[model samples]
Target: MSWWHWLWESEWHGILLGRWMVAVLLLVMGLGLAGLLASLLSRFFYLSLGKTQEDITRRELHRLMRPAWLFAILLAVLYSTLHVLEFFHLSTRWVDWIHRLFQALVLLALGLLGSRLLAVAETILASRYQQANEPYKLQLVHPLFTLGRILLFVLMGFLVLETTLKVNVGPFFTTLGLGGLAVALAAQETLQHFFGALAIFADKPFQLGETIRLENGTVGTIEKIGLRSTQIRTLDGLLLIIPNKRLADSPLENLTRTPRRRVLFRIGLLYNTPETTLQALKSELEESLGQLPFTIEKPLICLTNFQDSALELTVVTFVDPFYRAGNSSTPLSFLEIQDQIAERILRTVRRHQPQTDFAFPTRTLYIQKSSTGLDALSEVSRSGK
Candidate 1:
C-alpha cells in the first residue's frame, strides 16, 4: 500500500485523516465567516453613525466585536466536534468531559465579552458625567464607576461558576452567612470608611480642589476622595491623609463655597489723638478700601472700642474669597489684597498727620508722700541748715 493510503486508513485515537481534515476545514471556514460578518457590522455602524475610522465609538465597537465573533466561532466548532464524534461512534466518557471543558471555556469567553461591554458602557457614562458642571456629581462619578466595575466582576465570577463548572454555591453562601458577623467585626473600620465615602457622595459636603477646614484645625485643599480616605494638600505643602469616616463625621468647613471673604481690621490709635482726626482717618480708609479692585463693596469703618491704652477702630470689608481662581476678574490672593489695603491705610494716615503715633501700653504714676513724712523731711532740712 502507498504511504498516503496507510495514513488515511490509520486511526490513532478515534478520527481518521479524512474526518480530521473535514473538522479543520469547518473550523477555519466558521472563523472566516465570523470575521467577515464582524467587519460588515463595523462598516455599517461607521457609515450610519457618521463616525470616522479613528472615532472612540468606532474603536470601542471594533474591540467589542472581535470577542463576540470568536465566541460564536468557538460555539460552532464545539457543536461540530460533538456531532463528528457521534457520527464516528467515538462518543466516550472522556469525550463527554472534553465537551464539558469546552462548554466551560465558552462560558469564560462570554463572561469576558460581557465585562468588556460593561467597561465600555462605564466609559461612556463617565464621559457624560464629567462633561457636566455639577461639582457634587463630578465627585460621585469615580467611586460609583469603581463600584460598578467591582460588581460586574463579581457577577461574572458567579455566572461562570454556576453555569459552566456546575459548582453548587448554596453551601458557600451558607458559610458566608454564618461567618458574616465575624467578617463584619474584622472589617469594622473598613466598612465605616466605605459607608462614610458613600455618605460623602450623597451629601457632598466638599469637593475635589475645594479649600476645606476640618474640625481638627487642618486646613487644606482637597486633592482626592477615595473609598477609605481623603487626601488633602495643606498650605504648608504637606499631604494629609484623613480617614473618610472621621472626615465625614467631623465638622467640615467648605471655604470655597463662600461667595465672599470678610476681612476684619482693628486699628489702634494714640489715646490722645483728636476725635476729628479719627473721623477723618475713618473716612479716608472707607474711600480707599472702596476703590480697591479686590473689595466687593464699601468698607464699614467705625470707632468700635475704647482700649485701656488707645482707641480701637474696626474696619470690616468683603472681598472675593481666597484661593479660588476664575471667580473674579483679577487673580489675587487674600493675603495680597489684605497687604495692599493695609499699606494704603498707612499711607493715608501718614499723609493726614505725620506725627500721629500708634498706641502703646503706658502707665502714669503719681507719688503722694504722707503729710507726716514731708514735715519730717522739712525739719531735717532745717536742722542740717
Candidate 2:
C-alpha cells in the first residue's frame, strides 16, 4: 500500500490515524477559539470599566487585561491537555503535576493583578490629593502602596508553597521568624528611621516646602520626605540629608507656619536731643510704618533706655506673611522690607528735623591747668593767711 493510504488506514493502540488526527485538529481549534473568546471578553470588560476613566488608566487596564487573557488561554490549554491525557490513558501523576503547576501559575497571576490594581488605586488617590491641594497626604501614597504590594506577593508565595508544592509552612514560619529577628538586628538603624518617618507623618511637626530650624541650629527648607530620611535645601543652596529619627526627636521650628515675621529695630539719637523731639519722631515713625504695605501689625516705637552716649529707641513691627522669605513671587524679602523701613524712618527724621543728629560714641574731657608759679604761690599764701 502507498504510505499516505497506510497512514490513513493505520490503527495505533486501538485508535485510527484519521481519528487521532481529527482529535488533534479539534484540540487545536478549541484552544484557538477559547483564546479568542477570552481576548474578546477581556477587552469588553476593560472597556466597560475604563469608559469614563483617564487615557492613562485605560492604557494600564489594557496592559493588565493582556495578562489576564493570557492566563485564561493557559487555563484552557491545561484543561484540554488533561482531557486528552485522560482519553489516551496517560499517567495520573502527570495530571496531578500539571494541575499543581497550573494552580501555582494562577496564584502568581493573581498577585500580579493585585499589584496592578493597587498601582491604579494609588494613581487615582494621588491625582485626587493633588487636585484638592493636600500634598502632604500624597506623600504617603508610594511607601504605603509599596508595602502593601510586598505583603500581597509574600502571601501569594506562601499560598503557592502550601497548596501547590504541598509544603508545610509551619516550620517555614518558625525559621522565618528567627531570620527576621536577625535581619531586624542588622537593620536597627534603618528600622528606627522607618518608624521615625511614620511618626513624622502622624505628628505633622513639619511638612514639605516648609522652612525649618533644627535643634542643632541647621536651617533649611524641607525638600522631600522619604522612607529613611528627609531632604533639606539650606539657605546657602546646599542639600542636607537628615536622618528621620534625629529629625523627629529634635526640636524643629517651622518658620513658614507663622502668620508674620517680627522685626526689632534699635535707633540711637544724640543724648542732647529733647524728649519732645523724640516723641515727635516716634509718632512720625509709627505713622510711616502704618502706611507701609508690608507691615501687618501696628508699630511700637518707644525710648527703651538711656544709654551712655545715645538715646536708645526701640521699634518693633511685623512684616506681612506674604513678604516673608521663600516667596519668590514677592519682590521684597523680610530683611529688605526692614531695611526699606529703616531708611524711610531715617529720611523722615532728616526731613522733619534737619538739626537732629544720629548718636555716636563721644567723650568730653575738662582740665584746669595749675596756674603759673607766681600765681600758684600767691593763691597758696592767701589761703594760709
Candidate 3:
C-alpha cells in the first residue's frame, strides 16, 4: 500500500539499501576466498612455468611467482568489484563513481607492477643479449623495453582520466591542448635532446664505450648515452657531459669503428745521402715497420717533395687502433699515437743513417757596412794635396 512497499515489490528491489549491504558482505567474503585461491594458483603457475631441463631453486621459484601472483590479485579485485556492483544493481547514480574508483585503483596498481616487471625484464634481456654476441640485436634491447613501458604508462594515465573519472574525453582533450602546448614550449630543448637520442639509437651512431669527437673538438669516449645528455670520459681523465641535441646536429667522428687507423706523414731524407743508401733507406723503413706488430701489412711510401737540402719521403702506414686498457701502458690517444710514430721514425732513421742529415729550412742573408771616419780622412787628404 505504501511507496516503499511498491518499490520493494518491483524488479529493481535489488538496489535497496538492505540488498546493497548484503552484496557488500558477500563481496568481502568472496574476495577473501578468491585471494586464498589466487595464492595457490600462483604457486602452481610459477612451478609449472619454471619446469624446464634446468634445475629450479626456492628463491628462483619465488621470483617467478611474483608476477603471476600480482596479475591474479588484480583480476580478482576487478572481478569481485564488478560482480558485487551488478548484484546490487548499482547501474545508476553511484555506478560511475564506483567504476572510476576501481579503475583508478587498478591502474595505479598496474603502473607500479608494470614498472617493476619492466625493470626485471630489461635486466634479464641485457644479460642474455650480451652473451648472445649479436651486436645489432643487442643494441635494440634497451630502446624497445623503454618505449614499451613509456607507452603503457601514458595509455594508463589517459584511461584513468577518461574512463575511470567519467570525464568527457573529447572536451577534456580540447582543454588540455593549451596546457600541452605550454609544456611543449617549455621543454622544447629537452624534446630535441630526446629525439636526438632516439636518432642516435636508430642510426647506430657511436655506441657506448666508443671514442668520438664532436664538431667542437671535444674528443672523449662515450661512457653513457641518456635521453638528454651523453657522458664522456676525456683523454685527460675528466668526465664530460654533452647535450644530445648538440651531438645529434654536430659532425661526429667515431675512431673505434675502424679496426686500424691510417697514419700519414712526410719525413725528410737528406739529399746529401748516396743513391744506393737512399734506395736502401726505403727498404729499411719498410722492413723495420713491417717487423712491428702494430703496423699494417702495407707500408705506403710516396716521394712527396724534393727541397734544396732534403728529399721528403711521405711515410704512410696503418696501425691497429688501441685503447687504454689500464695504467701500465701509455694511454694511446690519437694525438699521442701520432707523436709516437713521428718520434719512432726519427729515432729509427737516426740509428740507421748517422751521416744522413735531417733537413731544415734554408736561408741566405747579405749586409753592407760604411765607415764615417774613413770618408772624413779621405776628404782631408784631398784638401791638403
Over 221-256, each residue of candidate 3 has an lDDT whose tens digit, in order, gives: 888888788889988889998887888888888988
For 225-335, candidate 2 gives per-residue lDDT tens digits of 998999999878999998999888888778788778888888777766667777788888899988888888899998888777777888898887566346577546555
lDDT values, one for every candidate: 0.73, 0.77, 0.68
Q: How far is candidate 3 from the true structure (C-alpha RMSD, Å)?
A: 10.3
Backbone clashes for every candidate come to 0, 0, 0
Q: What is the full ranking by lDDT, best candidate first?
A: 2, 1, 3
**Residues 59-136 of candidate 1: C-alpha lDDT, one tens digit per residue:** 676675567656756676768955764546645876667667666666666666666555555555555566665656
TM-score of each: 0.79, 0.73, 0.63
Q: What is the C-alpha RMSD of each candidate to the true structure, in Å?
A: 7.0, 7.8, 10.3
Return the top candidate by TM-score: 1
Task: Report clash pairs, candidate 1.
Answer: none
- For model 3 the TM-score comes to 0.63
